[model samples]
Target chain A: MSYKAITLKKRPETVISEDLFDVVELNQPDLLDGQVLVKLSHLSLDPAMRGWMSPDENSYIPPVKLGDVMRASGVGDIVESKNEQFPVGTRVMGLMGLTEYAVSDGSNLNIVPKEIPQEAILSVVALPGVTAYHGLFEVLKPQKGQTIAITAAAGSVGSLVGQMAKNLGLTVIGVAGTNEKCQWLTEELGFDHALNYKADDFQNQLTNASSNGIDLFFENTGGTAQAPIFNAMNAHGRIAVCGLIAEYNKTEASAGPSWVGIIKKRLNIQGFTMPDHFHKFPEYGKALGQMLMKGELKYRAHTLEGINSATSGINLLFSGENKGKLIVKL
Target chain B: MSYKAITLKKRPETVISEDLFDVVELNQPDLLDGQVLVKLSHLSLDPAMRGWMSPDENSYIPPVKLGDVMRASGVGDIVESKNEQFPVGTRVMGLMGLTEYAVSDGSNLNIVPKEIPQEAILSVVALPGVTAYHGLFEVLKPQKGQTIAITAAAGSVGSLVGQMAKNLGLTVIGVAGTNEKCQWLTEELGFDHALNYKADDFQNQLTNASSNGIDLFFENTGGTAQAPIFNAMNAHGRIAVCGLIAEYNKTEASAGPSWVGIIKKRLNIQGFTMPDHFHKFPEYGKALGQMLMKGELKYRAHTLEGINSATSGINLLFSGENKGKLIVKL
Candidate 1:
């Protein structure tokens, strides 16, 4: 049997392009002992995928090698299984790659609940949701009456962070690229205030929005946008370095904010990856699921049809074109 | 009684100069009902003084006002006491200023023990020692067999950090500006390896010295030297931001290490001020004193005589000229 797969052909120097990958059909091997063959239904496109494409040894995970099936997280159904634990037709989510079929020995695989919607599973209960959970509660440790400022406010993780901050009785200020995204943040996501970073009065807007000074800065885009936020940070503020999507595509080093701010403010800046804290995923999923069931948590998934659109769908993340979680539906 | 005092005449733009201060002779005031007259003996000069001179509202403590006696910590003897708690001839230390005489309400003062030498009381058992202890044990939390890298390794805080890290069974790598300071770090301070950041092969030396990767970075000097160290940091490394002595004299913002390194390495960087952690000073002083009594912890005090040398003594910290704790003996 043959199935389609997207393979990394060449690493890009800057922003990802469609030419970097090649979609080809490959034969599926027969399932061996304790192995299961999964037919992928959805592929999650994340900003971190850019880091994995870089040939440099700077990422937490190893770089995707040339001519290999591109690494990705996806939800799928087991079409054939030799493992008793993962029986045939068992739906699961894992690092299953951007391919039509994946063979796993049950390592790094999770059984998806039938209750959660298929699209919501990847956006609200998968990597982005869990990442937002760990970063906000575990790392930032929000306190009541504190102010939280988040970048990429319209994106999956940032949107979730703003909602979570609000639920905990903290003020939420969000920064996004477009005016529409800003409106969505404040109106749809219930953010206290949202600023368009591309606006001419962005600096003034940020200062006014964070009048009490930001207590917790959930940094998603780390570039020029963070400079003003750093200056407005209160003493002993905490910065959760979730993602640097702004600088992810840049080939050369850009001037960062004066670190003097960190010292003078006595700030605590910590960076984290979700996989490292996977042990808490079950607890996080349950909590997130409860919120979703209560209609307290909201998420959006920008789904691209077919595996062929995987390359272009990922570009939406860097371009800020994706309204929410970018995903490729197979 | 007439006594000399160093007053902040003007704030400097960058590097401290003698013109910024005025050595004025003023008549000492009569002690009030609750006040004590102190004959200041030893004035503690620290890198933090540079921050205090900045007219900006960035420091934890407000900037020193022009014409006010320059803020400093010092050891003194009570010459006259209207307050019975601080009787005559009682040796004490506090923010006694850069003056030959001062009047205190006995609120902030601490009675010094006769067991420790006068200079050691200020250098080892006081601010610098307590700062190092809190930064190392409380902030960085070094583990056995880990590699600890410290900048400004020959300075008071850095030197103490290296010694403590060694005692904790961690490999120590020190970074300094001059070859002599680097030599002293390895030879006398027992740092496993010392790298001269000024050497032509500095980057190579840093990479080789931290071959296992730096687990803990005690940052004293923050500038170009830290860029390479950031690249050499291990996953989940902790950076205790102590001082930015290297950037103390720079008027313009210089490029910092790509913050991308922090996210990729998942590093935890926290800046701290000693005054904020004064509650732990007694615990720290006891541990440091025990180490000193065992001859396991050694410290040096480079004392400048008279209040007139206050301006130049402070410049020593920025120029990296002082070999140890920069202090002024009045």
Candidate 2:
């Protein structure tokens, strides 16, 4: 029997395009003594994938090797198993990659509850949830009643961050690219204020939205919104740099504001990635699951059908076209 | 009796020109009960003075008020005392302003050892030493084997920082604006490598100096040296933005490098000023004194004679003409 998988063909020069990947068919290997076979149901498309496609040894996580199945996390279930802990029909989630089937020796897979839909798992209990939880609660160390400004607030991780902050009694200001996304952030996600970064008066809007100045900043899209939000930070402000989706595609990323503000405000800026804290996944997943059940985390998946669409569909994230979490149904 | 002092007459629009200050002779006031009179001997000139001359509410410390004696820290002797704790002939140091004499209520002055020279006290146990200690130990938290790079490497604080890092078993690279400063850093200060930031191949020199990539960066001068040093940082790097002297005098500060490298390296950047950490001064001062007495820290005092010269002589710090610690011998 054979299944399809996407393999990284070349490194991206500037932007992600079709020539960077190749769709291939692979034969299913016989399961070893302790192996469990998982047929993936959903694949997550994230901005981090752009980094994984580039060959930078200095990056937080090592890039996916050329001629190998592209690296990714997804939801799947055990169709056949030799491991007693992971029986047949047991649903699992892990870095199962951009493939239909995976043979895991129980080291890479975690058993997940089946009642929760695949979209919910990938959206709330997977990479986006963990990234948001760590960056907000750990990196930013936000205090209740503090004003927080989040860029890319309409996207997967940003939306969760805003919701979590809002629930914790913080004054949330969300910056997005489109007014419709801004409206959705306020109307659907319950963000206090959402401003379109594309507006000519974006800085004015930011200043007005944060009358007391921002105390915490959750940076996801390091774009036009970075300077204004950074400038509006109060004394002793903290910033968590989680992602720079806006600058990843650019050959020459623009300059950030001068460090004089960093000294004047005595700000603390830290860049973090989830790979460093993978040990806390189960713990974070449990907490995130509780929040999801109580309806505290409202998630929407702008999903694509089939694994073949994964290659081109991931570009929506860089273009800021995806309305919500971008997922693939395998 | 009258004593001369420099008063802040106007805020500098850009550079710290002599017109911004007015030299005036102030009549000595009769000491009330519990008052002590200090005959100022030596005043410390630092890059931080530029910020104090401007009127910015958002600054870490309040700016000097218009029509008021300019703020500065100095070592002095208690010539007359009504306070029992500070008897006549006792030595002290505090923010006594750029003056010939100061009347203190025993609240601002800290008693100093009579054994140490006033120049050594100001250079090693005062603002410069404490700033260097706090930024290095508390902020950078450097490891013994780490490679650290410091800008303004021949200045009061930077010189101390490099020596301390070198003493602690870390490889130290010092950067400055002149060949003389760089030579002093390598030959006299025992810095492993010293590069002139103004050289045409500065970036190339930095790359050669830090072949393993820089783990710790102590930024004092945020001039052209910032980008090259920032670009040469290693993964999980830490940067302490202690000062930006180059940008302080500019009408408009230039932009910093993009934050994309911050994420790619998972870097930690923190900005700090000594005003926020004044409570630890006594502790830092004691530790610094021990290092000074043991001959582990070497400092040179570049003294300008008389109170009147202080008004114009302070510019030596901004122009990088001062060989070491800039001091006023009043």
Candidate 3:
């Protein structure tokens, strides 16, 4: 049977339009040796999807070329398996492109258990959840009672980072774009304080919230949200330069105060891509999954219907229209 | 007997004028129970002294206030001693200040061997040598065959840094102000290459010199010297933030490329005062002292005639007039 998949129509402009993607029919491939065919159940739409759109020199992975199947990770079931490693009816999620059917070599794919809800496993316990876990615990290694200021804190990674930092005994402060996101962070997510970065006096509020100093700065968005937060960093602060969602679409280099402050404060700023720490995924999955099952973790999964809606779901991420992990149910 | 000591008459502006220092008379104090009266000999005048002149908040030590005895480290004779730890006629160097006669509690002081020439011990094997040793091996830990770049490469610390990196099997590159200093770095110092930063095509020369990529950046001077060097850094480069001599006396913040490149390159920038690593001094001193005695290391000491001439000597550092360690003989 023929299956439907999204293809990149052309390179995007300042804003991603529906014209960038084309939904098309494709042949269902026969499973080769050591391969499994998966029928896509849910597709993960993340901010990093923007980086995969066009070729760039500085990113972790090569960008998606035009007319190719758009790259994505999705949770799905095994319809056929040529290898005993993954039997028929086994559920899996890995580098499955944006399609109704996908075949994997089982190189890096893992089977999802029947006990875990496929949607829940695809949502809070997905790559976004583990990215937060490893980035905060492994990269930042913030100590107890230290103040942690995280940007995009009400979003998927930021929300998890705030909760984890609080669990680790840190004074967690969240910087969200809206009052609703901030309220969720402070009331529901256990963040000690939340500041709206869109507010005029965001810096002032941050200074009051992080009175001691920002020991750990988990940067997600990189423009105006980052500028003031950088100023509030303490001496010898550790900044995990996780993502630059703020500068992803912008053409020009964003201007800000001199980082002589970085030298003066003796800060450690590190740029990280999640794949660099994939070795810790098993450990992260075990711990973070336990926390979720115990009711200690609260996460929201924003799902859009149909694989064709993947483009719009991804764009909503940059526009801040979605509150959490923006996924597509195929 | 009255002895002369250097005193700062006024804070310096342009080149330090003759009137900036005054020779003052003093009655040598009787040694207290744990004190010693030292007859000061070789006084060290460092670029860090220029840091002491400005009223900046961030400092290794507070700036020597106007009309105060200028702060310095020196070798001296213990003419009278009541302390059991240090006997009479012992040669010592510590915070003896810029003076002919000074009283020390022996808290910060260290007794030097009478056999080592006072000038040799005070010059090559002194604070500058220790600063380079600890900052490089302890902080940067550059591996063998790696390219290491140092700013102010002809000065006391930078000169030693190039030599030490060489000894550690690194390909050393020096960035200096003049052709002569550049020649000195490449010729006498055994550095692989030296780039005269004053050249119009200095950035090109730096790229050509460090063909492999800079693994360790020993930053002494800031501003124009540092702007382009950022591009030459390799991934996971370590920068020992030794000093910013270029901006030490400037009243305003000068513009340069921010360390955003550092983040992209995954650089580790650490600013430190020597006192912070005082625990490791004994280990450094022993290794460096052995290197000096073997004639494997070389240093230049720019000697000033009298203690009263300290102001002129200090300003000479900013003007880049001094060839090496600027010191005063009292």
Candidate 4:
């Protein structure tokens, strides 16, 4: 049998283009002993994928080598399995590549229940959701009545962070690229305020919205947009650095302020990747799933049909073209 | 009776000069109800004093207003007291300005035992010691066998941080401005390694000294010196942002490298001030005091005599002229 896969053609210096990947046909090999053949149905597109594409950057995960399958989190079904634990027809999620089929020994795979929707499994119950959970609870540790300002407020992680913070009684202020995204954050996600970072009055809006000052900053995007928010942080503020999508595509390094605020405000800035906290994902996923089932947690996914579209679909994240969780359906 | 005091004549934009202060003699006033008359014997000179002199910078304490006594931590003898808790001739320490006499309402004062040397009270038992304590114990949380790097490692806070970290069984690497300071750190303070940041091969030295990568960075001096250290941090590294003495004297803000390391290494950068953690002082002081008396912990105080020399003494801190805990003996 033949399966479709996308391989990294060349590492880009700055902004990623569709040309960086090549869509190719590969022969599907028979499952070896204790191995399961997973027919992937969905692939997760994330901002961190940009970091993984860099040849020189050191990250939590190893960089994708040239001519190798692009690294991604994906959900699929075990079509054929020699492993008793993961029998045929069992649904699983893991660090499967951007491919139509995968061969797994079940090392990193997690069993996903049939009841959970594929979109949620690819989003709120997967990488983005678990990232939001760990970064918020473990890193930021928001308190009741504290104000939290989240950047990339409409993205997969930021959107869930705003909702969860609101649910936990934190006043949520969001910063996003567009007015539409900002509107969705405040109007739909129950955020106290949302400022379009692209707007001329962004600084004023941010200042006014966070009059009480931000107690916690969920930093998803790092660039010039962070300066005003950093200036508005109260004493002893916590900043959970989940991703820096704003600087991901830039050739030159972004300029930050004097950082005197870090001392004056006594802020705690912690950067984290979800994989490091995978041990807690099961508990996080169970809680997040329960919330979703009871309608207490809400999430959105922007899916691009077909695995072939992943090249263009992934760029949507860098260009801010897609709202919510960007995913590819194979 | 009259005593000399240094008042902020004007705020300096960068490097502090003697001209910013005016030495004036003021008549000692009668104590009001609940007030204690403190005759300051030793005044603490700190890098954070430069920040307090900045008119526009945000700080834990309000800036020392123009014409007001310059904000400083001092050890003194309460010659007169209306408060029953603090008897006459009782030694005390607090934000008793750079002066020969101060009348306080006893709001921020801490009673110091006569057995504790005035130099220890001004250096190890006071702000600098407390800052090193909280920053290491609470923020960095260093573990045995971890490699700890400290900037300005011969100065007040950094010196103590090195000794404490060494006592705790961590490999301590010290970064200082001069060879003499570096020698003192490794030879006297028991740091595993010491590098002169001003040396031509500083970067190579830092790389070789910290080949295992720094686990905890007790950041005292900030600016360009941080770039190499930031790059050499291990995964899950912690940085305690105690002070930016390097930038304190710079007219233009120093350019820092892309903070990609903060994310790439999952570094936790926490900035703090001692005043904010005053509640932890008693416990910290008791432990530190015990260590000092038993000779388990070593510290040095470079005292400049006479209250009038405070103008020059403070400048020594920016010039890196003072080797250890810079203090003014009034």
Candidate 5:
């Protein structure tokens, strides 16, 4: 039988256009002694994909190579298994790439419960949830009553971060690109304030929202809102730089705020990606599962239909048109 | 008796000129129950003095207000004391201001050994050495066989940082402003390599010197050297922003490198000032004293005569003219 997959055709110069990828047909591989065959059901479309498409030597993980299946995190069900741990008909999730079927050696994929919807699992129990849990509790180390400003607050990781910060007794100020997203953050997720970064009086809105200056900052988007939030930080502030969605496609990334503020405020800024902390995923995933199951966390998934929609649907993330955590259904 | 001191007449706009200060004379204070009078013999002119002159609300420590004695670190001998721990003829070091005499209630000043020269005490046992120790060991948390790059390599703090990193078995690359300073770093201070930031091919020299990418960066002067060093960092690099001597005097402090590198390399950047860690002084001072006594550390002092010279001598630090740790002998 044949399966379809997307291959990285070329490295991105600026924008991640269609020319960067090629759809190809391939025969399903026979499973080896410890391997299992997974038919992908849902795939995650993330901002981190932009970094993976580029060929930066200093990137946290190696870029997806030309002529190779494009890398992605996905949920699937086992159809053929040569291993006892993951038997046939088990639902699993892992970095199974942009493909309909994958042959895994039982190393990558993990068994997940079947009762949960794929969207809920992808949005709250997979990469987004784990990233948010680690970046917040480990990196930011929030204390009760501290004010936290999070950029890209309407997106997958940012939404979870805001929810987690709120749970820790912190005042959460969420920054999004549009009014609708801002409204959703405050109304749906219980964020203290959600200001649109595009608004003219965004800085004023942020100041009014945060009566006490921001003590912790979780940076996901690096654009117009970066400097203002950086300037508003209090003494001994901590910043966690998780992603730069706005900067990924730019020819030249914008300069960060002056180091003078860093010294004066005695700030500590740390940059991280989820891959580095893979060991803690199980630990984080379990805690996040509890948060979701107990009604402490809320998530919305903007899932596109069919595998082919992934190519064009990804740009929705960059344009800030996607209303929720983006995913693709096969 | 009346003693001379320099008072900040006005806040600095750009340069630290003589017009901003006034040579004032004040009479000795009548002793209170626990108050003591110190006849300041030596003063240290450090780059951090420039930050104290600015009225930045977010500054690590409060700025020196107009009509106040200009803040500085100094070593002096106790002439009169009501406290037994710091009695008459005892030597002490603290932020005694740019003066010939100061009154203290034994709260600020700490007693030091009288045998060591006041210049040595100020250069190594006081601000410079402690600043270097805390920044290197506490903030950077360096390991053996790692590569460390330090800016302002010839300055008081940078010199001590390099020597200490050397003691830890790390390869050290020191960036300075002058060739003479560079030579002193390599030949006298035992730094593995020293590159002059003013050199046209400084980046190339740094690349050659740090064959492996920089694992730890001790940033002192944030100018031409900052971005290059930032870009040259290895995976999981650590940065300690101790000072920005080059940026402090500018009308507008320059912007730092884009945070993209921070994310790409999973870098950690921490900005620190000594006042925040005042309690650690005794602990750091003890370790530094052992290094000095055992001849593990070497220092040179550029001492200016009389209190009046302090006004003019401070500019030497900004101009990169002072060859060694700049000090005032009164």
Candidate 6:
């Protein structure tokens, strides 16, 4: 049997175009010892994948090599298993590539309940949910009644962070590019306040929205959002910086406000890669799954059908075109 | 009985001139129920005093008011005592005024060895030594073979930090203003390397000196020194910012290097005031006193003979004229 996979043909200029990924077919690998074959169901598109596409080294993970199978996290069903840990008919999510079928050593694989809705399993309780859970509760550690400011509030991690902060009894403030996204955050997501970042009086609006200082900041988009968010930060504020999707493909450094604010305010700014926090993932996943079952959390997804349209789903993340988790159905 | 005391007549503009301090004669107060009358001996002339002179909102202690006795730390003999905790003839050090005599509640006072040289007791194993100890092992936490970089290397805290790091089996690099200070750090203090910040190739020297990257940075002077120090920082490096003496006297905000290096490199920058760590002083002071008594540590002092000379002693600090601890003897 053969499968289609996107190969990194070349680095894209600004917006990732179709030329960046190519569909390739190859023979399915035989399951070796301690390995299993997974029939991919859904491919997770993340802002971090943009970092992999780049040649520069930023954090823990290395840049994705040219002509290698484009890296992704996907939910799949075990077609066959030579490993006793993961038997046939089991469902798993791990470092499965952007392909129709792939083989894993069961190294980072986990099998969850098949009774759960596939979208809920893949969306609200997947990477986005886990990222928001650990990044907010574990890293940021917001106190009740403290203000939490989040960037890209309509997007996967940001939306979840705002909701989680609210659930933890925090006053949530969100910044989004459009008026509709702002409405969706405050009205639908139960955020205390939301500001349109593209407004002429954006900074003023942010100041008005958060009269109380921001105690915890979940930074997703870095460039323009960082300045106002930092200004509103209280003394000894904690910032859990996850992604800088705003400056991903840009040639030059994103210029805005002075970072002396960090020193003057004495902020704790930390950058984290989620896999580094894998030790806590099980706990986070279990907790997040319970929250979903209790209807205390919400997640949205922008799904693109087939491996052929995966590039478009990834590109939509950069443009803020996708409302939530950008996924490709295999 | 009357005593002469230096009062904060006005805020200083340059070098903390004579007019900045007004000497006035006042009748000595009777010791209260819990109070002790102290005869001032050696007054510590710290760079932090400059902070106390101005009405800055960001100070740990309130600014010395106009017509009020200037705040200081000194070793004094308890000539009269009503407090059971501190008996008469005790040699004590605590927060006092720059005066011939002071009355205290014995709340902050700590007795010192009468046999120890007055200069040695006032210079080392006091606030400066404790600052170095707690800032290094407690905050920065340098490990063996790792590189530790310090600014103001010839000063009290910086010198002790380098010596302690050396004793802990770490490679220590010192940054000082002059060749003499650098020589003292490398040749006498046993620092592995010393770079003169005034030299044209200072940044290159610092970078070359810490090729393995700086695991810890003891930041006493924050402005110009931060650029080179940060350039040499390792990933996840820790910086203990004890003071920002470089920018302390400036009337306007000084332009300095961006701290975005902190976010990119995942560095931990913490600004600490000595009082916040005063709880560890007893433990730190005992250990540091042992180090000094064993001849494991060395220090120097630039002493002013009279209370009238406090202004000149303070001026010497900004001029970088003092080789070590700047003190005024009463």
lDDT of 3 at B39: 86
Please provide, for model 6 over B1-330, each residue's C-alpha lDDT reduced to its tens digit, 9 standing for 90 to 100.
998888998997645777788889989877769999999989988887887887754356678899999888889899999998788899988778788899889878888878777788777878888888888987788888899999998998899999989998999999889999999898898999998888998878887888788889888776667777876677788877777677666665454443344445666666566775677878887888888899888998878898888866777887788989988887
Off by over 4 Å in 4: B32-35, B55-57
Highest lDDT scorer: 2
Question: Against the unseen true structure, what C-alpha lDDT does each candidate score?
Answer: 0.88, 0.93, 0.80, 0.87, 0.93, 0.81
Ten contiguous residues with the weakest lDDT in model 3 chain B: B255-264
Ranking by lDDT: 2, 5, 1, 4, 6, 3
Question: In order, what fnat does every candidate score?
Answer: 0.71, 0.85, 0.23, 0.65, 0.89, 0.10
lDDT of 4 by residue, B1-330 (tens): 999999999889766788999999999998888999998989998887888888653578778889999989999998999999889999989988889999999887988889979998777888888888899999999899999999988988888899999989999999998899889888888889999888889999998998788899998888657888888899999998889887877776665556667788888888988878778888988888887788877778898999988998888888889978888887
Predictions' DockQ, in order: 0.70, 0.85, 0.38, 0.64, 0.90, 0.28
The parts of candidate 2 lying over 4 Å away from their true place are none
List of clashing residue pairs for candidate 6: none
Instruction: Report how closely model 1 matches the true complex, as a DockQ value.
Output: 0.70
Q: Return the TM-score for each candidate structure.
A: 0.96, 0.98, 0.92, 0.94, 0.99, 0.92
Off by over 4 Å in 3: A9-15, A118-124, A255-259, B7-23, B54-67, B114-123, B255-263
Question: What ranges in model 5 sit over 4 Å off?
Answer: none
lDDT of 2 at A190: 94
- lDDT-best of 1 and 3: 1
What lDDT tens digits, residue by residue, belong to model 5 across residues B143-177? 99999999998999999999999999999999999
- Give the per-residue lDDT of model 3 (tens digit) for A1-330: 899999988886666788899999999877778988888899988877777785755455788888999988889999999989889999887778899998888876777776777667766677888888877987798899899999888888888898888988999999988999999888888899999988999878988998887899998887777767887877778888677677767765464344456556666676666766778777878887898888777888888999878877788888888877778887
Give candidate 4's whole-model lDDT.
Answer: 0.87
Q: What are the RMSDs of all candidates, in order?
A: 1.8, 1.2, 2.7, 2.3, 1.0, 2.8
lDDT of 1 by residue, B151-220 (tens): 9988889999999999989999999988888888888889999998888889998888888988999999
Model 2 clash count equals 0
Model 5 clash pairs are: none
